[model samples]
Target: MSTPDTTQHKLIVLDMAGTTVADDGLVELAFTAAAERLGEDPATMIDYVRATMGESKISVFRHLFGGDEARAQLANLAFEDAYGELVADGRIAPIPGAAEAIAELKEQGRTVVLTTGFARVTQDAILDALGWRELVELTLCPSDASGRGRPFPDMVLAAFLRTGAVDDVRRIVVAGDTSYDMLSGVRSGAGIVAGVLTGAHDEPALKEHGATHVLASVAELPALIREFPA
Candidate 1:
């Protein structure tokens, strides 16, 4: 068996929603609500949405609408509206210790970035809710990275390009809460790919998709980072 690669890391790419923030199934609620408004089968659409967690919202819409771009755009707009209302109603919260972990990482001079599948406005709402508008060095959405999100490595690689803090892909750690997040990290060639159980996918699903480590939540991230071999 090959020995585990233990490269020293300098950057951490994180996922929002179920990873760094409390999900509370709000995304599902928003999707189901949109589906109901669109007169689609809520059960089927929700199952599809759950299966494609971490994918771009537009892409998910496209899939749900059977590749009808116009209809997908309408559905996506509805989703954004519903999610925005939910956020405005104070239904979202930060995951316990997430802000602390981010602050700790920043204090160590490590580059920490937040990546999300949500659109820009929705992501900003989350940041505003958590009062983390300035905590992370950068915040990214699928549109910020050629409209491609997780499971494609676009967002992770975009972090490398946008931040310029990453001298080498192998010196990066990618942590999130979904299989798509793990797959993106793996495909991006990051040295350490971790998954947190706070999101949509479980440890087994994450591992199957290429998670090098799995944690109970983002609260455990700092310790995991500190334990990486120098």
Candidate 2:
């Protein structure tokens, strides 16, 4: 939902991996499993996996499989198998202060949309665990959309549309941990683009890519929102 002001909306879109969840160990695990399927070293394959953080799972898998549809599909099966087991075993949880930040946004009457590169299978459970299912009004996962994911503004534009923030871009604040997230926010004409170091990039990298604000993590979001004018 939007603010009561009615003059413009107050929208916040959050990214998953580095922004909301700490997948450092799970990511490494998935890489190891997928690499085994490819007969490669998990350590050697990490760069590829981490580089695809802001992309759809299929996109990431496809890259790992050398863009071959058949191999990508096979590798994806293995990766998901490993990741699913990890989640089922209580090995994953929301990042520090993630749930609190989203709750604060909602309490302030802002529309908080979750945009991620995760497929529904992964995102649904994550949201469910974090008890954030009802707090969000929109969820845009790449598997459900068109165009490239991040660095293309596809999901950002889609979030704006479904959240009714398209007309009031000034009230839009897109936050993520990847350079792709920052660049996509800029391309989407968002009023604010904040980057978090807890994700895949650092403060300097985020600023170099045109972030309006760079914070340590999503934990700092409530303060930032409060300081921003209505």
Candidate 3:
């Protein structure tokens, strides 16, 4: 009997905001604007927002509003609008070499999927701003994966099922810049959960959360993937 080839990672799932796109505090700024617009004080929630950087925005709002679905929906809308406007202003940029790394991954016959915690509208706006509408074969928002995002393996599993890239979940590679990203990857049973330092959390937080490897930036990811044992 022949054994399955399990050496190479075939599916790559990457986070959008902090991993590939350099938002530079736009999420916090948008949260503040949204809170102010909703007649709430940003101070009461900014810390939570910062702490849960890679979580679904609507999920955050749901918690902040104490499960008031209406308020959470409103807040999520306002936050998405504020974020879309900032993206329109060109406040976000691709992390240096992020695009190249993705391209290289694709060139190597690996499937790349971009996942974000933002709503579909905001995710689209950021992609449009970066001219990355087609950068990867798939781009997922929390909504795309049954409305679940990081800290829950929904998006990662969604990518696995939707792309049909690899037969084994252990062949998936998940990369991001936050601890939640690490948790999601871990929950999904991915082969590698790599945390990059170009965004929210630091090395210790990522490592503590479940990151198998810590990198300086997404730019180093291609080489890491290539050098990973088969």
List the RMSD of every prediction in angstroms.
Answer: 3.0, 3.5, 2.1
- TM-score of each model, paired residue for residue: 0.95, 0.87, 0.96
> What are the per-residue Cα lDDT tens digits for candidate 1 across 72-135?
9989988988998898888888889898988887776688999999999999988897788988
Candidate 2 deviant stretches above 4 angstroms: 1-9
* Candidate 2: residue 169 lDDT (0-100): 72
What TM-score quantifies how close candidate 3 is to the native fold?
Answer: 0.96
If both were scored by TM-score, which would come out higher, candidate 1 or candidate 3?
3
Q: Which of the two candidates, 1 or 3, achieves a greater lDDT against the reference? A: 3
Model 2 clash pairs are: none
List of clashing residue pairs for candidate 3: 7-230
Ranking by lDDT: 3, 1, 2
lDDT of all predictions, in order shown? 0.88, 0.78, 0.93
Q: Return the lDDT, model 1, position 127.
A: 88
Question: So what's the TM-score on candidate 2?
Answer: 0.87
Which lDDT tens digits does candidate 2 get at residues 1-230? 65445324478888987898877667668768877877767776688667656766667777766779988777767777777677777777778998889888778778888987766777776667667688678887876558468777888888878768547677788999988888889988887899998877778888988799998899898778777655
